[model samples]
Target: MLTNKGTLIPIGGNEDKGIEDNEQYTLEFIDDGILFHVVREAGGTDANIVVIPTASSIPVEVGENYLEAFSTLGCKNVTVLDIRSKEDSEKQASINLIKAANCIMFSGGDQSKITNKIGGTEIHDIIKYRYKNEKGFVVAGTSAGAMMMSQEMIAGGSATESFIKGAVKMYKGLGLVPGLIIDTHFIKRGRFGRISEAVAQFPQLIGIGLAEDTGMIIKNKRCRVIGSGMVIIFDGRRLKHNRHKILTEGTPMSLTGMRTHILSNSDSFHIEKKKVKILPIEAPFI
Candidate 1:
């Protein structure tokens, strides 16, 4: 399912941060930088940003980081929803915060933690509702947060180790978007093979590999790459052969004809059309 109502930003891990003079941890000082794209997508300085740190083990610390970052960005209404358990996820207060937020940002941590705690909860339902029905709403996440944005997510395993048949294990995600799987810290961690294996296994699903400091702004099933690095897309629709059906786990996989593309900043790709636009059309004549 795709919606043109809201924006979805899935950022790779290692976002900029710093420590304040007061000894409190916060994001690095910079005007309209770091999470500038996020702020802009959520209505800028006046945006009401809700930081969900459920995926992080250090929820309090991680939550504070986001709060400080958004606050420093001139977003007066910044809140951190530290959901540590399934019980906390279903709380009315939590649901209310999510419903009222202009943007919901999932912090970096364990993707499984988020799915296990918030999946199927009232808060989750509210998020889905706002994303589908409301306008100007934004959903953003980094690392594990990014991985969980799709219908199917890569739970674990590196590219090298998961090169064999059935070696890659995927888990159900938030399903904010379906028919795709996302992998973060891509190039730095050499995750191309992992995402490739995932595509080979599920040829119908598109695989996205996001490098650090890079991300994709997805709207209505169309994706635009952003940040300093690249977004690798593994399209397996032309897959000629894969012994996945007959091979067992750990067996060498034979995959062929998987088309791949590297998208840098400003590049856009249409999920349905499977086309890439390298440059934006500019206004002619002044």
Candidate 2:
């Protein structure tokens, strides 16, 4: 099933769930994509990694900061592409970066900007193609960067704000992972309500609320929590609602008998099964 918003509707079926129990989707979530996370994992070995910093709202310095961080990852050869500029120079640079990288990281910023800038661009297509061909490429993001991984993004704000109708105003995401709605800065920003609203709008989709400094490593349809925060899984597959007239914003709309699971770092959750496989800890690694 697919949502009206163009996101994959979470359905109960073999195909709907990415979990096969035997296979795992291998992905790494780093603080950023290059120097901090991917490079460290590389351990001085040369590996392809792409960095998308559109969410950073600044220029990514490849030689200055990125190189230094990448060295720690033991990467001898590194290429950094700053897609934020999207100028002719940057576009060409982005093409080269995507073509060479084994892993792609999307930085935190306004998701709308990131998607608009690179969604359908050549860079995006190249990365997708490479990843699909089993180049051992891992894609990751933080905050807004993470939001764009899902087919349906959480572009709407709180119910208190003016809602521009028409399926929550979503743009074309990178489509790295489908059928899931991802939100960042979850706990700190009190974004549960917003994700809940998204579920109400599309109950078929599983809502993943990731707290700051925390990330969910998705492999083979199952998610492993990694970071210092909590990940809230909102499963509305069994949601029930009452018909009412004249629904107003922030009127304490009641959702009777809705259940949510809170998972912390190193914990795991199954999207299709809608169940928590492990419990989270108080102290999670970054």
List per-prediction Cα lDDT, in the order shown. 0.80, 0.58
Residues 83-164, candidate 1: write the lDDT tens digits: 8889998788888888889999987778999999998888888888888877789999988888998888888875667477
Residue-wise C-alpha lDDT for candidate 2, range 92-199, written one tens digit per residue:
766777777666666555788777777777877776675555424567666677788887887657533332223244555677666678877677667766777666
Among all windows of 10 consecutive residues in model 2, the one with the lowest summed lDDT is 7-16
Q: Extract clashing residue pairs from model 1.
A: none
Please provide TM-scores, in order, for all candidate models, with all chains considered together. Answer: 0.91, 0.73
lDDT of 2 at 205: 79
Residue 188 shift from truth in candidate 1, angstroms:
0.8
